[model samples]
Target: MWIQEVGEYSKKLLDKGTGEDVVTYRRVQGGEGTKSSQQRIQVNGDGTVTIPKKDADLNISIDNGEHSNYFKNEVRGGNADIVEFDVPKWFDDFLKENTIPQSGYNSNPLNQGGTAPKLVDPTKPGNSFEVPAPWVEWIEEYAKNAQIKK
Candidate 1:
């Protein structure tokens, strides 16, 4: 166990528009949630990826669509995201009891940002960017209508 979930329960977006039959969110079952965390994406030789996370180590096949593109174009080049990381012992125990997802998607799902975000887990040192919460379903709303903006 290397990753975990530690946050308030989140909801699944049922619908996102105003109308008579619209629901913005729905309750997720207990012990099931989405949480955000900084993860290490390790592309493997067998066309797969190994993500070490607080929840569990995820092995993903890079055989189609974006996964394939990412493996081919960015894995061994400057586009590859590299960071120095060290995991503490306590966090491992925490993951044994919770779920920290290794994958997520943005609401709009487009690759059109000129600048990537600079996010850090303020609790740690050296530009730390790791799991933000233990477990809580999360989604990126990087759009014009985003509620959070600088």
Candidate 2:
């Protein structure tokens, strides 16, 4: 018995199924004594994208509303072909778990200047902003009246 080995060729073909058409590709890589790697993107006939299960889960877990809106706008409104990104793991955790402080801006150290602060008269140079004690008191009192204490 004799067997013949066929050489690999790079090509794309359309697969017909259900109602939607699917496309697939096969490519050959490497040369001589080197190793070869093949990568392909697969899409289902129902128009759903095929990605690794882990990636899908990461998408669900990250679930950033801002990023979700941006993606929808870019893909649906802007009609982009491809969007790719890398976000830090900590950022994913932050988006998944972080919450807005219930104290509003009045109690946060970063917002110690209070809400609607105004700049004071220039005492020396470029920027001379000051948080008025009256504004801080009013904001705190408003927060208290609004029952937003935290």
Which candidate has the top score in TM-score? 1
TM-score of 2: 0.18
Off by over 4 Å in 2: 1-82, 94-150
Name the lDDT value of residue 76 in candidate 1: 36
Worst 10 residues of 1 by lDDT: 141-150
Query: Roughly what TM-score does model 1 have, to 2 decimal places?
Result: 0.20
**Residue-wise C-alpha lDDT for candidate 1, range 1-150, written one tens digit per residue:** 222222111111222332222111111111212322233343344323334443432221111123322332333332233221112223323322333222231232321121111122223221211233222112111011111100
Please give, for residues 21-138, the per-residue lDDT of candidate 2 as tens digits. 2211111112122222211122344333333321211111012223323333332233222212222333222222322222344565644444323222223222112233442232
lDDT of 1: 0.23
